[model samples]
Target chain A: MHPLAAVRGVPRRTWLRWRFAYLVLLPTLILFTYLRVFPTAWAFVMSFFEWGLVKPAERFVGFDNYTTLLSDKNFTTALLNTTIFAFATTIFSVILAIALAAVLARVVRGRTGGLLELLYFAPVLVPMVPVTLGWREIFNYNHGVLNAFLGIFGITRVPWLSDPNMALVAVIILSVWKQVGYNMIILIVGMRAIPRVYEEAAAVDGASAWQRFRHVTMPLLAPVTLFVIVITTIASYNVFTQVYVLASDVQGAPGRLVPVIVYDLFQNGFRFFKMGYASAEAVYLFLIILVLTLIQFRFLRGSRA
Target chain B: MNLRRRGMSRVGYWILVAVLALGGIAMIFPIFWLFSVSFRPASEINTVPPNLLPVHWTLNNFTVVFQRAPMLSYLWNSFVFATISTIFIVLTSSTAGYIFAKFKFPGNNAIFMLVLATAIVPFEIYMVPLFLQMNALHLVNNPIGLFLPFLVLSYGIFFMRQNTMTSVPDEILDAARIDGMSETGVMIRMVPRLLAPAVSALAILAFIQAWTAFIWPLLILNDPKYFPMELGLSQFANTGSSNFGVTSAAAVIALLPSIIAFLLLRRRIVEGITITGLQG
Candidate 1:
């Protein structure tokens, strides 16, 4: 209902109090829709048409773009690769984050604890480009830090990002390293919020340390855990700048992770000038995220019930 | 968790702390490596059985970076973009967040939810069309094009709204209104003062986001001088491996300002990031 709905049956001058909210909200709404909403809607509209940057014309192609996308090797690769990336990064990062938070929350307290927490949170500040580039150097096939360290143990140099089998793992590790701290901070706060009474109750019942955490702490931390999963999954699936720097020859070295979605989109839209085709890919990506997010909301609502 | 109350030994406690501390160091090792490699000579950078510390520390890489490109100018481009964008986003997000959190206006929930939904949609979804949109506006080669899309961030608005819900009480606004302050005046004078923490947190986050921005800037701008340092760092990698030392140095320089900003405002960044994570 309108803020003026109650006043609609009355006079306008009598209830003009809340109209300032609309006035203040206009700039943000206008700019946001203009920049974000308009472009997104335009992408959807262009997906069904043969929009080309080269020929400078558009034709209604219906589901042709979609069909073409479904058959594209790069598209299929991206679909599988992105799924693996999302789930792997989310799960691995979440597990490490939980363990770190639980331990730090228990063992460390005081100024030292605070300092350590800050140190843990430090990577969250580093950008994707630097982190990815740095890791690219570290993951180098020869003379890289990791390979050199492994060599110290009498192991041969192992190609990190270059090997097809290890490429996804390398990517996952790169992301997880940057992400764990943010999740740790969140989980720590979540753990801190869980009342000590629950733990005490579990303790009095003769639950061991592991048992108490498994039964009491884990159950109570479900909401935050679910949140972490959804966030990390969404972020991981969209990892582009890192992949661009790591895999593509955009930097000096060619990347081995061939089927990542955003990189595919970049190649299509920018490199190949297939704006319409790329738009279709974008639509699929958007729908996947939308469905995932909706599923999360549904699960949370169900848990509440 | 009061796990200590259950008769865990002091030795075990220190052992756990030491292990966790080691893990912490390991987690940030890449950053430490980046810093260490910044000073390493070209020979030591790719040496087998890599020296943990630089064998021959040199400022030569820094000199190469400066001589090769207008690196500081690139940093200036990034700094200006980050600063200006942060200011605009902070002002815009706070104003909108104040309304969404405090006012019961028409379309409040609907509009707020629309902004919230954008958080889930990655920029790639609309990035092609956005490129065309910028092209239409003749901003493809313009710096404004790089910063425009981020001027009002969804996460900033959402974070500010969450902070406002808890921080700014309605009674104070009412009191301000009663004292003859207009609605806008009340917001400008009182609400912002109260939202200082949220504003600072949002500002730091916005600064970093804009500073580290890559894809859009890479697409939007053409000239090397207009390039942000994030994009500039790519040249080192793209051009060749011979400049590996300077490449690492450039990467360090690119990340330095944001790291400094984050260090100065780690408390706020942590709070801001947590609110985002919690709400998600």
Candidate 2:
């Protein structure tokens, strides 16, 4: 009965179903376009101009912002810091998670295992701001618990947050502690999903426990391990809330000492009102993550083959 | 597998337990310190050797936290933002997911792929333009701006689509169609109940994300009255007069809702993360 339906020689029911599908998808598609697609395109365009927040001084800058970023010391620090943070966090968290999952797989049939899993996962549930705050107190130089504990060994208080090098290490430590549990759970699930027959066959072939795990369990877990690494790297590269909360005070690390990419973008975009430069930085961050993700896909496909 | 276990001595098993128990303690000690310090009296907070438990417990820090800032308002704002955004995310994701999974239409796979592609683009990449857009629309500093970017999550769409395909059967939908139920009627009546588990999982994930959001709220909101708990707590800690006890109390209060939610919906949350591969 519909005009298009009759013209296209389609059944009314089929046309109606298509109509219903489009009708259902329309609102979400429109929203996604407006909020996500449009803004992403706009950011690219804005990156090419000298965009500002306060003044109406927007003009085409012809890649000057990108060139300036080459000489910018702060941006360089942030890039280096983010790279270190990402690599350290990913490697440490992934290895520790695999170890924890391996142990738990052997002992996880009962209530005690569940309780331990929950205990490790508890930090993952608590909000980052508060947990970072708790870590800040522990990392405090004087009269803090960590310092007090170290004093027992007659090791003088280490300024965990104040020194630039130590501050990065402290951030990495916090990140690993918060993230290991989540990866552990994922790896545990991955380990469980491995059919037991392979391990059984290996054992029957006179493979020792270590030998079976090295060959059988490890190979199967490659995909999940790669997944954890990729996601952790991406997440770590976007680390902001912890750095912002932890380094903005006198008691905590100085922001300049613990510079990260998102913090750089936030500072440039919001604090200094340098929208154009910030967009360029955002594009750079996007490219790094994009490349990382593409590498992951390639690696995943390789492993599957 | 049993043979492998049989080779291990009893001593090894207990050693493993002891090591894991120690690791668990390390994992939970910071959280324990948070609550312990929060209950300490202000005088005891500055002691040279910090006691793991408060020497004398008092509720004065909580009272101080409430008095210093608009703590109640911050909690309310967070609740409203997280709840409303979660409802919209669940609704949009479920409907979009349902269509993508069940319906045959042109460009279905392409469109779904497009939506999923956006998940890989971090918010930091586009937030500059988004801020300008919000500013142009006069939404900055408004509560609506706090959650505008989050109302439609790409991950939620992918998650819901995967769930709908796995759980919702084609026969049931065809039967409903034959029963003369309008597509909208079928969706309204049956899809939600059928997809209840996935819906709850997505809802809790979205809620926790919105509730814990900080940087966007910090960027969009300047008014103290509009601050979410994250922003509020940050500001509280930044104030020069803030002390250890009071600040810890504020942090504890900000963390309470998530702790409560995690405890009540542990299995669902865990299941959701495992399925979706969502990191906190």
Cα lDDT tens digits, model 2, A207-268, are 87788889999988898888899999999999988887776545543355699999899889
TM-score of 2: 0.96
Interface RMSD of each: 2.1, 1.8
Chain A TM-score (model 2)? 0.94
TM-score of chain B of 1: 0.90
Clashing pairs in 1: A78-A259, A247-A255
Q: lDDT tens digits, residues B177-264, model 1?
A: 8898887788889988899977876787788788888888888888887898788777656667445678788888888877886778
Each candidate's lDDT (Cα)? Answer: 0.82, 0.86
Q: Give candidate 2 regions above 4 Å deviation.
A: A6-9, A54-57, A249-254, B1-4, B278-280
Error of 1 at A267 (Å): 1.0
Per-residue CA lDDT of candidate 2, range B207-251, in tens?
888888988898899899999988888888877598888889998
- Fraction of the reference Cα-Cα interface contacts (below 8 Å) that each candidate reproduces: 0.74, 0.75
